[model samples]
Target: MGMHDNSRCINCEWAVAGTGQKFCPNCGQPTPVHRIDWHFLGHELEHSVLHMDRGILYSLKQLMLRPGVLLRDYIEGRRGNQVKPLLLITMMSAAVVLLNKLVSGGSLIDGGAHQAIATGQAVPEQLQQFMLASRTVGEWISGHFAAFTLMLLPFEALTFWLVFRRFSRLNYPEWLVISTLLTVQTFVIWLLLIPLHRWLPYAQSLAGLMGMVYGAASLMQFFATRPLLSTLWRTAVALGVFSVTSTVLVLVATIVVTWRA
Candidate 1:
């Protein structure tokens, strides 16, 4: 009947807004959609359920091939095609965690060291508080494994900002985005190495080394105008500064935590 033929959306009564309006303006469902079928169900499952066609792999591939260019582009606002930095790192973090759990059945942080510090009676007098503070830090990190991993974002951003300030016109938040994608790079390296090393602790050293090398390469590309040797030394300084700063923070936090306790 004539009544069966209408320009309105089936999901919502909003009429087609324009000649080529693909989705309803009111409800946002596709206008004049296909009837349910096995093929539609399968396609929906792939697209929505698993996100089989998502930007996850594409982002990783781009990062691998051109880390500095990709990150610099992303920071400069050329980010429509790939996965966002935060999501990429978060997903990579989950992958690393899952793989660690499957292989070692152990937490990324070493709880036994903390437990030993708590239980031992002969930790010496002066070192006792220090040990306890370390234990406190370790416990928190262990308990919040995912968060602990992501916690490096800001500090890393600050570290890079300080070392590369002369070269980069980027602000603090932009550095954070750059840091996050770099973190995704690190996590991807960890994911690959952890399985071979059979656990986090064993794989961690090599993973860290590989990550630093990757960072150096990325910096070289990002600062392509600079000599490669100059970029390499700057990356080295950045890593050293990051390490020292992180150590100081942990020690200061340990003292504060123990003092308050």
Candidate 2:
């Protein structure tokens, strides 16, 4: 253990006990408080302990390896060592957006319109207008990718809530949390696969499928009390609902933006 300035509670100024206490009696912060140093590199880092400024890797590991268990634990109040769900997903969204830019030259979503316009390709006046509007909408969505991702999460969360309602005791907010973590795991997958875009144009598709697999696996393990086959079909149904709803929403959004442009 690193040396701790256990004379007083740094947070609340409460007098310390006999140095064995792991948390402050007043503020409840972890004790034996040492500076964030090489001890951070030691076993003291303890990624499993949640809510006290742990690394992002720990959250990703749990999301990948035991996402259902992690979600259930967080929902049921074992949330000490985990990163905030919103914060984690936002950061992952930013990371995924940045990686997409780096590997795809930031053109993956522009649908080749950017290159066509930039190269002075011959085009009809109507087509030119449409391309410009589409490019603008695409750029805006990419720039605000985190917000865009969050906007889509509600639809998926609602689907999950409705599909799993009978088997689940979780409320809508808890389902939202589960949806966020599951969605961000796809971001984690993208971070791993996006760099391969130079050699694998299909990497994004593969990542999407992998994300689906992870989400299905998470639900299967999470609701193990339900029949496995039932869970599988329900999951598929939930995803189908999310897909149709989100697609309509996106199409409407694109139309609005395109019209305004």
Give the top-scoring candidate (TM-score). Answer: 2
Residues 1-261, model 2: lDDT tens digits: 655567888788788896788888899987767677787756555553432345677777888888888888888898877889999999888888877877677643425654688898898877777777777777778778888888888888988999888977788899899999999888888889888877766665677778888899998988878799998998889877887887687667666776776
Stretches of candidate 1 exceeding 4 Å from the true structure: 1-13, 17-21, 25-54, 110-122, 125-129, 198-201
Task: Report, for every candidate in turn, its global Cα lDDT versus the true structure.
Answer: 0.75, 0.80
- Overall local distance difference test of candidate 2: 0.80
Lowest lDDT 10-residue stretch of candidate 2: 45-54
Residue range 1-261, candidate 1, lDDT tens digits: 133233887776778766588888899888666657899898776664346334677678879888877877787788876787777777788887788778877665444445556576576655777677778786676566568667767898898888778876878888888778777787888888777754345576577778888988887898888788877887899877876876787678888887887
State the displacement of the C-alpha of residue 234, model 1, in Å, after optimal TM-score superposition: 2.1
**By lDDT, who's the top model here?**
2
